[model samples]
Target: MTNPTPGQTVSGTITVAANATDNVAVSSVQFLLDGQPLGNPVTAAPYAASLNTTTSTNGAHTLSAKATDPSGNVGSAAGIAVTVQNPTPPMTCFVLQTSVTARGTGTVQTGAFSTVISGEVLLAFVSMDGPGGAAGQSATVSGAGLTWRLVGRANSRSGDAEIWTATASTVLHNVTARSAPAKGGYAQDLTVVAFEGATGTGAVSTGGAASGAPTLTVTTTAATSLVLAVGHDWDKAVARTLPTGFAMLDQCVDTAHGDTSWSEYTNQATGPAGTPVKIGATAPTSDQWNMAAVELLNSGS
Candidate 1:
């Protein structure tokens, strides 16, 4: 009761201490939480007990202590009220829920992808028509009762690759995307992937290229982050292996414009600061391409 003062907010493991001075020699002291014995009684000075706040509910708690003399006389200290607020454990890794891919001209809509948990993170990678400019074409995604934000993009005459993200409060089904200046003849490929346990924030690092292979690299702040790499092939080639150490999420081809788009992700943590996560430049080298990457963080990162 002396360590955690009344109305104090505590988290993690904390020590509960008390003082007892008996007229006769104090035989033992016992600490209690909400009138229950905290641990074995202490027979020495500096009476205290270790309490893990995480084990208790995150609300008001009471602490008190009792002391006894040899004659069985006991004295109890007035209970002191305190609050427990334990931190949420950090997510060890991101769990893949579902992914959907699509191809079409103008506005692109992905097929339905389901998730069992709410507050899940939805990442959409869209390969849209880029007229070879300094920047990639801007596109917006809608659906899942969430607000989408563009993470990064890579633009080239071949095509444009972009990464967008949102947090779904309810179950998500389909997603729709359209370029800022919609063009009927401009074809696009969409890949929507969902994961649970993300913080729903922007990428820790982003990288892309207008042609050839991508040299985008990201150094993850947390080991639990999801590293996403996407590319758009202007040649409309759909058959290509993903970079080493990454698992393919989804890929699509828009035959109308002869453009193909593919996405891949890895939950593995890139080592130290100097070491970075990257997509190898070997695959999909036959075509002019645009590549983009984003690293979404895990919860408690």
Candidate 2:
């Protein structure tokens, strides 16, 4: 074949062409791939056929053509070898590596869990019952071999909800959440989750709530990202349902003080997702609650 010359690497759609001349008169020209008919014979000149390489396996392929004479005599051209090379798809990066939850009086800490991937982002959601506000009622988070930063906080008349983040390496460790003492002794629930493939701690879209639905609308800053939504409720006896299209990571309750804490995540693609990412939950009772949401970017996003 003249086009897609021997040893050429082809991808997507390309034209296959051949030159043929007969003593009598060439009635038609037929194209073949690997000795099989490629399509209906061509009745016009410039003997050529269009081929979509994606339909064939990504490997070596052979191209040839046949010309038919009025007398029924057919002549075959020598086959040319070519390689099909299509682009490989990218692999999914956002994945949950580990999760832990703790609840009780005084300082609450989750059990140690091993992180399987390096450069994973660690998240902590703490809900405590006591005086409500950001003053001395908020919770603080820490871990070994990691540095934690407060992303956002929400407060209710009966309790306070806080979110913290840390960039972590592969290690075995637990997270601690201690409520400030000035809150007059409190009971708290803490949930810590680790996710691999996140490049670093991203920006918080929105946070803080007094009561009612714990939802937030945010536009992402990265093409591929991991969006997280978390909520804390005054009714510790009930479990909060995650918003639609989100996967649950962890949820816990501090039964002693009647407070609940939970977290969920969704992986976004080919975006700076422009949709309203809400952590809309189904709460059984119309009680005091707080919610927060953050967007974490992926590597090379």
Candidate 3:
């Protein structure tokens, strides 16, 4: 009897023999598996059997070889074990991140965002960090803005939406993640990152990439000092007059946010000798400036 190999459809042969009585003619041979007859083999002295390919998997099978000689003499042989193995399949996976920073603040802000197609998060790095501070951090998360608290977690979220809000008082957020159903498709990431907006500046670039995964880069621009002015009711013990290298670069004829009035300004292009200084300052009150919301630029490019 003939059969395919364990994993494949194989062919096998069975031999029949007869004593020198009469020229033995063949009667029939049978193929069996697991004590059941597979099929009839009624050809020549050497009989063959065929096995189906579908029946084989990643295991072993038993095939029996039984035959009858022309003399009507029948004999059965024990089945042999045949093994078939399946081929291993290939694998697949993906990643997504930001190459740009948040718009409001000059500093770059990035983290894993959710998928547009399935709402799955390829990455989720949002929320705030450090000591207790959330009131001033109440940001309007547009794409999916999360509120920051003292620790690196969200105190609450301003909101999320498919459409953009147009209010100047409202801060808008956009997605940083690639949609699972739209383009890239790895949605199990949950690494959150948020930037407390304070007018910092910088650029972004994809950092190092994982061996087979992708990396994202987000950069921003920011300044260490803001060109602002204030009165000398400023305390030296509680708060010193900037304590260091900071001079009024400009001043305003009026006030806006309750601080002393001032407009945005920069140093004179040519030299420090001609650098602009804050005007209208008297003794007890000094025209001054200091690191402006400088922490926001920590991730600056």
lDDT of each: 0.68, 0.68, 0.27
lDDT value for model 2? 0.68
- Which regions in candidate 3 have their CA more than 4 angstroms from the true location? 1-23, 86-301
Which residue pairs show collisions in model 2?
Answer: 223-271
Model 3 TM-score on a 0 to 1 scale: 0.22
Q: Model 1: runs farther than 4 Å from truth?
A: 1-91, 130-136, 171-181, 202-211, 236-238, 253-256, 272-275
Give the lDDT of residue 257 in candidate 2.
60
lDDT per residue for candidate 2 within 1-301, as digits (tens), equals: 5565688677777667676788878999999999999988987665678888899999999999999999999999999998887863344355566677777766776675655434678788776666645334667777646778889876644566777888876444333433332364677767777775577655575454455666666567766766776666765557776656777766775565667767777734435555455554755446666667787777641
Clashing pairs in 1: 236-258
The list of candidate 2 runs beyond 4 A from truth reads 1-88, 132-136, 169-184, 206-210, 253-255, 267-273
Q: What are the root-mean-square deviations of the candidates from the true structure over C-alphas?
A: 17.0, 19.1, 29.8
lDDT of 3 by residue, 1-301 (tens): 2223223322222221111112465467676767777666645432444555246555666676566767778777655665433432221111111122221111123453322111112112221111222221212222344322211112221111010111112222344421111111111111232222122222212111111111111222333312221111111111222223344322222222112211121221112222233322222233221111111222110
TM-score of 2: 0.61
Better of 1 and 3 by TM-score: 1
Candidates 2 and 3: which is better by TM-score?
2
